[model samples]
Target: MAGGGGGGRSLEETPTWAVAVVCFVLVAISIVIEHIIHLIGKWLKSKNKSALYESLEKIKAELMLLGFISLLLTVGQSPISNICVSEKIGNSWHPCSKQKEEDAIKGEEIPDDSSEQHRRRLLMEAAGGSVRRMLAAGGEDKCAAKGKVPFVSADGIHQLHIFIFVLAVFHVLYCISTLALGRAKMRSWKSWENETKTAEYQFAHDPERFRFTRETSFGRRHLSFWTKNPVLLWIVCFFRQFVRSVPKVDYLTLRHGFIAAHLAPQSHQKFDFRNYIKRSLEEDFKVVVGISPPIWFLAVLFLLFNTHGWYSYLWLPFIPLIVILLVGTKLQVIITKMGLRISERGEVVKGVPVVQLGDHLFWFNRPRLILFLINFVLFQNAFQLAFFAWTWYEFGLKSCYHDHTEDIVIRITMGVLIQILCSYVTLPLYALVTQVIN
Candidate 1:
């Protein structure tokens, strides 16, 4: 895409091989890296101390969710590409207005020498109908060249190179540095054991720490409908088995104590970060971070290679972003409702269990910290939704983008709602569906 080949072609016109290959390669790389991580973990298990592995594992799940989001953005958005031609992967991604504005300034073919024309363009964009009116204005003006497509600097070679080089450097350095810590005497398994014991002792003395257990699931009211669907539970139970096959890859930050309490075996649950992070090296807690870089690399390749078929699914990567948003929002719901469930007897509460909680599933059991995370995820979700909504209004509905399907605001809105519903309600909805089928 960088040189002369893909410069003028639309996304639909491009071949799928480039993007598909990129995706494949990145995924392969991720698999390889994870294998290396596993080997390191295995080696640590032999070493008996594994202090370095413990440290890396502690940061793994945090890296997973955060890195996954970053990977999504990295691959889906042509961070390196100008806005006009930035489309790459993912289902829910959309070009931000700021990026588009920059692209317009850099890629604009029409001479903007006239002050009058520039002023008029600014006003139209601010008023929210920039495209249609601008096209109309371009029609009346001699310089507009009505039928000619606007020029764009579609070459993203520099952007891709810089991003890849910098990320690779950081990635290499970070990996090496963490591995180097393994050589030191401090981070060994013994050190981790001591830290875990200390943390456990502190948590036991703190009466407020009980909230970080499994009781923070969705309330009975939100899940009232799923109680009747036994078959749906069966399906989820079966699905869990398949997922558990690769449990090591499933670890992620979303499993704060609340999520963990519901996802792991209730009998042996622990709510300490210190314990869980080390356990993550041995289990499913590090999946997200392990896979993020490879996915991101593939996304970058999608852009750098100038892959075709970006518009094929109206941005498939965007869907995952929203799903991630839904999961985070659902957690906020749990935290908000968690307060109402506490009683005179203590942290006993009722809710739907998504999965069994892991020992040390939470980052920490401190009430203040938990409260802060809840607030943080809430504000973050709100900002993302706002941005998505704005982009939908500004660009999605506008006629300028390729294809009528993507341009249909009504359909896009409904699709988004449906996606959100599927994210949070799929298991229960499956149960409801199975009841009817049975």
Candidate 2:
């Protein structure tokens, strides 16, 4: 009945091209934010000059990106207002769009002899078509009520936007605080490294001070001996686990043991720690880039569906979250496989073989399992895209006056639910299929 709520501007007054422009601007802003965070990380690495600092920078950047994405998905769209008609029948309120479709199904028809009635019917039909077009284009719609029913309100939508904005702001601040603490920890680690080197030198040059004598009393041998040599005391305090595992405690044994425990791979060696850290950061960045498109598509679809008044499918908003989980799981499997390959090549970290950790069932120890997960991820992505297209075609293009809409929605929802359930039950399903093939 009334116009849309942005400064009394009607939905029809907003050009469809403006929606495309807004989407473009939002995407540009997201890219700029990501680049700025990356530059900040580079600058922090230059200033701190520590691998730990670089790691912290990656974490801060990821946290900020996640917060920004959450805000964009939740509150980036135009506020909802006066977009649809809602009728209050008794105490329950429902969209008049549904009511109109129900009346049409009951064989309501315009009188052919009444010119005024025919004109009004034509106007209503045109208005309905325009509303559908706007929704399909990812824009809002406004409908003129034929009855005394009011336009749908926007107060709740505004409240939700404000709440999500506040949470996003808090998330950003939390990430900043964590970076500050991480910087402090980095400084402490640097000091500890220096002290460890100095202690090792002292222990090497003055081994007699750390050794025990045959005539020494028990109290002096245990307490006074280590207390007198602060280097030994510090080494014991820091490398207590290594000390416990050592078979014998002597100058050469303790010196070699400490060296083996503390020293990382040499920079010139094949598996450089710094390069490994950089590669890990790069892999994380690649994952973020890979996942952004699907999330953006899902957000646009959500806006379109919300404008079309598809409240029965509220679970649509969570699809992006599920997609993210699946992507992460697939990445984990990939990383584990890579780690296994490196381990097979005899790569070592800190004198111990590198081994990736994962659940035995899901870990890809064989080529067949790797291929299965790869195909599974591709199939899931294709299925989701197909499902979205089908829903959009059936509900957006075709009018909802037919009874088939309910049946279609139900069938599609069930299929999606089953597919998601199978994704989680992947290990069991894969084992079952393998046994059948055998």
Candidate 3:
């Protein structure tokens, strides 16, 4: 695909429709490749009856479905662009014609396509036109004036902006909606966990305890026994966590939550992994809720600064502050855990002995391993944060023009990235550091 282009001449000279075409083609080609992969996997499954073939079949089915969605988006880009620019000149915008200095010097009037002419002149300058060519053009300034040079390389980018902004807005909405749904799901899981725990605890004391229990009546009315069977729920819970753990955070303890809860009982049948997953989801959901507000706040801050001039760079200190604070929360969690580990000197909490604290921490050997993990993570986060700061400085503070020269989506995307960096990367790192140092 063609590059998005940079500097004054990049976006300015490229025709608007040209960009849409390249993007559409790129998506189409990717879908075709994925479809081929899916077909091969299906063929392999038909020829082989191995476990690996079964997994490949599942993977192929998923890839084919995803390819269909990818194709839809690629095919939709042009219509979206056309819809955006339809009211204004009908999406027929083109680059300016190459301006001829000789014609201008001969008292000739510029044509309607003078913009296209001027871009050709600029392209020549970009191509390193010699002094003789420059001199023949009667100086670059006069040529530029004839071309009606734009501050933003206004060539074709102005029209493209509408479509880019539209997608950015869509992404923002998609993210927020998912977050809301996730939180709601967490609440449901927590409520279910509490009821399950109460029922199991009551039944644990007596074999026939659940026969006349309130939970039996409630469970029957809400869901059949088969629906909530320990085996089926375990499959769904483990699979959901596995899916989430792959691309999302909490890779380690998220899965271990179920294991820890399971192993606490002497036998596997004595503990339910489904209930454990419910408990884990309930807690993990809180972390997501806690991290989301500040990310959105920062995103909005970036959107505002997106339109601002270089004066906005004065607020650079704020970025590091955000990073530090994010790291600090993790530190707080680590520190509290560490303190609990050491406080087992027969100290009493409310009426419980401090020795019980270790039992409450996540997973086996966490007290020994977690502190080391936190420190290493902190160092890495500190390094990555500094690196991000340097790149941000180069991309924004040191760039071409100070005004709204770049697209809003670029800034919006950058802002969203920073939030990810802070929440997922740096914050966890520093939290570890803070836990150790404090």
Candidate 4:
């Protein structure tokens, strides 16, 4: 099949499913063959020129041949449309080429024939091959030309090809970010234990003892006590469950505010801006925006399961960027408010607003704004890339959008259902896993 021949055709016409099945079978066969060859190779290693060695050598070569064949087949099935086909020249072709060179001739006016179809396929294949070859050959001109190949209006498969290209580009970016950020460094199951231990340590060892000399009737009433110190209310209510189990301390009189304070000094050193930012990012990574990891993980599972289906897989690219933007905006608003407060204090010079870290007030001035803008732009770009990929894929699969309305509804509903399930599962699991793991 070439150009529009493959587009909008039935699954049977392309037999893509059959191709996939063949690939799977070949892989399985190759695995079995490799194992057999490995055993024979090992057995032959003990004897240099024995009969066993000769037999094993033949088997090894066969296995290698099969492996190479399997790899080529798999690559052919890949969305990357790169393959070379050479055309046979004829006397009529020379006259047609001369006419085409002197004056552009309309291709569609030519009668459809076996020879024409063959030529078209060869030209399309050559285009694909040249695009890839240009990439391999280093130069700015080559790369610029290669960039334009996916969008050639002459090719009927241009839409499908470009959609895949955009997806491949986003996938590469995703892999790079994931590697750099180490987002999955720890499993979510261990969160509770680490958080509990940290809470316990802070409750026991806070250095600042804000003494209240006025021991009045307000103290006796208990209402004046916790109400006067909302910080005390948060600790006694939330932080005390784990703290009570750790060391010898009275819950009512244990005046350590740093136990539950966000800005408390972490072990080994007093808290600083760098460490604060590090811990903040760490917590963010561990947390799923609305719920727990298992649920979000399940949502991811659903997306992956539907990835091969047309239109169904269209939304896959957009989700990551959406999540990032949502989370990042939430964080920015929080930091902006905090920065405002820090700026008001005027004690610590420089940084964002209300938050004070050690000797400096967090400044919400020009420099911080510039930095936030840069971060926001990066986050927005990632989201847009994902969104564009999904929309572009959708556009390619259906010229008549009305035809796929039902499919669209079904996919959206499934996505929502999975995301809701994840939201429900993640919170409790996060608490449980954190307790157990670290």
Top-TM-score candidate index: 3
Q: What would the per-residue lDDT of candidate 1 be over residues 6-111, giving only the tens digit for each residue? A: 3345658868997689889999998998898788778877877555566457555544654665565455443332233212221123222433444444434224
Per-model tally of clashing residue pairs: 31, 0, 12, 31
| lDDT-better candidate, 1 vs 2 | 2
CA-lDDT, candidates in order:
0.35, 0.37, 0.35, 0.34
Residue-wise C-alpha lDDT for candidate 4, range 1-438, written one tens digit per residue = 324323354567768878899899989987896697677667757644243344345434433543454455444432333322232221111212333322222233233673644444323323322222222112232223434333222242343344434543443353234323332322332342244346565453333433231221112222234533545543443332222221222111111122223334343123222222234333332221111244435444533344222443355434433443333333323222333343344433321111222212113432233223323323233333543445435332231221355545544454343333222222222221122112
Against the hidden true structure, what lDDT does model 1 obtain? 0.35
TM-scores of the candidates in the order shown: 0.26, 0.28, 0.29, 0.25
Q: How many backbone clashes does candidate 1 have?
A: 31
Name the TM-score of candidate 4.
0.25
- Model 3 lDDT tens row, 1-438: 111122234546888898889899999987896697677667756865343344444434433443454455455533432222211232112221223223333324434675544433333222211111222222343223333232222222322343333433333333333234433433433443343346563354333232322132222222334333646533443333223212211211122223333355233234543344333333332233221334434444543453223344345324544443433333333323433342333232221111112323333534323333322322222322332333233223322212233433334444455444333443333222222222
What's the ranking of the predictions by lDDT, best on top? 2, 1, 3, 4
Model 3: how far is 54 from its true place, Å? 20
Clashes of 4: 31
lDDT of 2 by residue, 254-361 (tens): 222223344542311222222222333333222222224444455345444533355534454345335433433443233223233433454222322222323442
